[model samples]
Target: MDTVITVTGEQSANDLGVTLPHEHLIIDASIWVPDGPELTAIQRRKLEESVSMENLWWLAAYGRQPKWNSLDNRRLDDVETAKREAMRFVAEGGETLVDVTPMSPGLGRDPGALKRIANHTGLNVVAGTGHYVRHAHPPRIDDQSASEIADEMVGDIVDGIDGTGVRAGVIGEIGATNGFSDHPNEKTVFRAAAIAQQRTGAPITIHPPVHYKEGHDVLDVLEEAGANLTNVILGHLDGAMELDNASAYYDSLAERGVSLEFDTFGRIGYIASEDVCFPLDETRIRELRRLFDKGYGDQLLVSHDICKKNQLTKYAGHGYDYILRDIVPRLRRREFSETEITSLLVDNPARALTIEE
Candidate 1:
């Protein structure tokens, strides 16, 4: 029998309703900051940089603005506020949310925190395990062998994270930069995550680097490590998933049975390129349509990768309910049937997150 694990406990896959495939309950992606913390406002002023191609990619891809003090808004560590967000999601009909927080300073996913949110909001929150992007990795990561890393994550699945008794339900949102863009120790984590997946039957999710691409290289690595592509999902397909460049990557992923996640919905300020704006509400639907047209609907999933405080309703974002509230209605307008929406919201997630035997 198929089962979906949550922080609260195991539940029938049938009960996993309105699932958000990738999101962060409480996190801080400070590793994403350019030049690290050393490049502060004072240093920035001395550098006298206006806007360069280096900084544009951040706005173009991750939705980070050009404000002088934008870095301060990078955290969402408040548990009480997170509880309120989860409650709002539940009230708006959100049932299950995959918290893809990896291990990081002031960031990453903690199963214990997830459990607290699950208990308070009554929403089924699936917890994450495994290391994050290269920049956020622990000092021990460079020293840990692939098998060693796999063992740690296997412990997370079999036992629990931090002895809190909250077993992780998924293996990643494992960090990769730009389709395996060599983040110092990225390949090690990728291989270990693959081993852990085969060891534990937990699904894996990938968080690509800022500069997105075909993601074929990283997928190749995972496949080489014996990962089941169907049990794996390639997330943040927004800017990098363009067909014009490689054109064959999407079909390749679909043909290989890997799922594509258009999870960052409702973030409209960012632009993809001169031709398109990323996190653009309409572009998501358009891209989603392209996927469906290509017969990859069954392998598709969607969510809002809401990791910033500004994205919350208290801070005036669409909140956790934006997808079902706004995006789905737009899909309906675009001639997507109830069946299609159900596949995106309900069926695909159950398949994506289920602990396969």
Candidate 2:
């Protein structure tokens, strides 16, 4: 049987134009580090991994300790604010924005909040289901079996989250840390996510474990789950997009009919600070061209992955807006055809999100 699955009473993929397959409008701030100093040394160490320990120690000692209060007024759950921000995107020639926030305790998992935001914004908003990384999942989940987690995930898609009667439109941002290749938690989450996909036919989007190995591991989980690989998306591919490694990863996933996502288009500063150096110039166009030349154009999706509030200002001059204002024109300048560009920003995302007419 053909593996492509469709959403109920939704528009066809063609209707989703210039869509951003991965993004965040309103994300709960608690996921980064809950507001508390009671955490042990290990907890402090783990949370500070993204930042330099020297910088953190400096802040802890001489500088004011970084508090979560900076994030207090950044809620996107309000319909009016969401509408304004989303309007900025659509006015800039963007169409759909997939709100890939997962439900976790202390994190705002309000499906009603999403619905209200979408309704007010007039943006085609896609919501997601599934747990985040092991650290983000609720303590209660440890008491449940994989089957139980799968059942809950399926219910969230088919029914509604927390019995609120609001259905999630997609199945992930399912968190796997360190990429799928090495994490045991990734395997468990993959099993549950796979079971959920099999039952609901909701397309899966991976929050790939940190590096390339995780991407490979995610594919392993999907295949094991009897998922149609084409219905799966390997997210954060750009994070590992060294020329040789990216080509191989894209080729492998494309051959399996899975889509590859380079959704961190506007995160240059944050991503640059990481150990790995991401090529921020024409490297994006070069990568796209290489994928097109390799005949994988139809399976590529692009976006900014703007999770933090600061990224919005970071976007004002050079963020998500950069994709529309800068990158598209650059691709055109490089002689990329409109069809290829469309497939990357629109067609592929619609297919992965499984929006049906």
Candidate 3:
């Protein structure tokens, strides 16, 4: 039987109930933080303070401004806080959470911490193995060949991550930006992921660029590198649905047999901080219906992708239970059957994450 590897150990796929396929329990994503002279003294001080009710609105409005907001929101390193946030999902009947924090410098990927969280919460924590985008890549990456990188990833899957004895079950959210041509180091990591996937039978999930068209470029590199398209996932697709031909674009991506992960479930409204305006839940429901109507329900995955401090319940955001507490009921109202919801939350993740025997 195929088994799903967890930080604790191997688990039967049937037992992986009501899974959230993408999440981060412990992470430090400060690589995205910008240090520039554009900030005034007060703005810089505000940036240092933790996110709270008083400054939450300002942070949401200008968090990505680099010069205007706080950098504390870009980090999630407290294990106790992570444990508390994870339990919120557990209370809502969620079982498995795939923490896709890649093994890149400054982006905390801790298998020991993951194992501890699993032990405490009784949640199946599946860790990932891969490099992130260009900025997160280590300085030694220049000296390593693609095969050498793949070897490290393979070791993480087959043996353990950094001698922690906690094997990774998945191979991403390996990151890519712009297009395939623009970032050679990202491409190298992609190729390494493809190699590691073939060797270990682990699934690959990619963080593609914002442009929906550029997703195809990422697929091209993975496809050419001999990765299994069926086990590949393209994440953050919700952020790329603004163009006129988005529906058709999604259809084309579905046709390629890769799982399209719409992981930003609860992040609604305009994120002026980043100049990004995510579609409302109503719009996302329509898109799901569109994909379902086109016979691509099986090629879909969903999650909250809660990576920032403002996204947690402690900061008054929706927290990890948003999908179960809010979105699932909306799907029912929209006429999505129980079987369809099961396929999305249970069956798809089980199939995508199981390591072939």
Candidate 4:
């Protein structure tokens, strides 16, 4: 509650410069990989070939396929590659990035890796605790009680991760699946996350389902568990534009006092619903302005939810610097004053991520 826990060491929230509140420097997720011993060459080629333009569109509109999963593209294992990307973000006026890589196995369970990135690139980093989505968690999570899960999450925040003595500053990127359904495992984790938040005072960032109803359902679970709604950040709202009643939906959330994280700036291609017909950035900006118009400016945050290799510069995706390089200027041109921009980029992050304990 007193200081923001950075990978380097504890520091004042005032020192956390323009921050990307909901992003990941290294997210090695094997969530969607089809289980197999090994693929034959033809099978491997077929799997690789399955990732076509149409396939991505299908993924955006429909759901995951048995043959077509983003397995190979889900890893950011090269620390040097991540370091190069972090420096790019820092150089372009970004000071800190809260990496929501959780303690889930096969993902970002190693706090040492985050510490290494911060120590090398001199970028302030904050790691996360708890499991991610249901599919991302290990099988053991299903058998654990809520208190048990919360204890482990607290350990990740207070003790360390992977026995490296590097603590997590946040409790999530805790996840809910389509429609934010109260899947037993997801509900259990949500309850555990709320208890962890109440105990540790670290902010909770939720990876919400894209459906409009799912957002509110997630809040319901968090609130029922007595989590402080102010510190509860509902992420992935940029893609929520696919909803027809996006305005009213976001308004309701903002009024409930949760932070609205428009964390996917240049990530329009990664749609999940069939309704995204507008230009990506334009739709995002419009939706953002609606939130502001509804008097939710102070509770807003933005970032690039970069989780794939193609999302890096070398792989033809917009690098980590894209938000600063392209989006900020566009906001200025769209008549958002410097003061308004500062509130979203600077002030909101400091306040939202700061524990209320």
Measured by TM-score, how close is model 2 to the native structure? Answer: 0.81
lDDT of 1 by residue, 1-357 (tens): 798778888888888999998988878765554544656676455234333344443433444533332443466778998999888889878999999886544575667778888988888899888888776788898798999999989998888887888888889888886546555489989999999999989999988653456477778889999999889998877655443553365667678888888877876654323344354678678778888988989999898899876677876577888998888889999999999999999999999999988
Candidate 4: worst-modelled 10 consecutive residues by lDDT: 270-279
Question: What is the Å distance of residue 164 in model 1 from its true position?
Answer: 0.3
- Candidate 3, residue 340: Cα displacement in angstroms equals 0.4
Q: Candidate 3: what lDDT?
A: 0.87
In the range 240-346, model 2's lDDT, one tens digit per residue, is 76535666766776787888888877544223223454457477678889989988888888888866444454223244466887789998999999888878887
Error of 4 at 233 (Å): 0.6
| Ranking, TM-score, top scorer first | 3, 4, 1, 2
lDDT of 4 by residue, 1-357 (tens): 457877777878888889999888887765655656564564445445433454454334332333444565666777888889899998898888899988788785556778888988777898888878888888998689999999999998888876888888888999888855648899989999999999999999998874444788888888999999999989988667766777788888888999998887776553232435323887888777777877889998988888876677866678888988998899998888888899888899998888666
Over 166-230, each residue of candidate 3 has an lDDT whose tens digit, in order, gives 99999999998765578888999999999998898999989888544588888888989999889
Q: Which candidate do you rate higher for TM-score, 3 or 4? A: 3
lDDT of each: 0.78, 0.67, 0.87, 0.79
Best by lDDT: 3
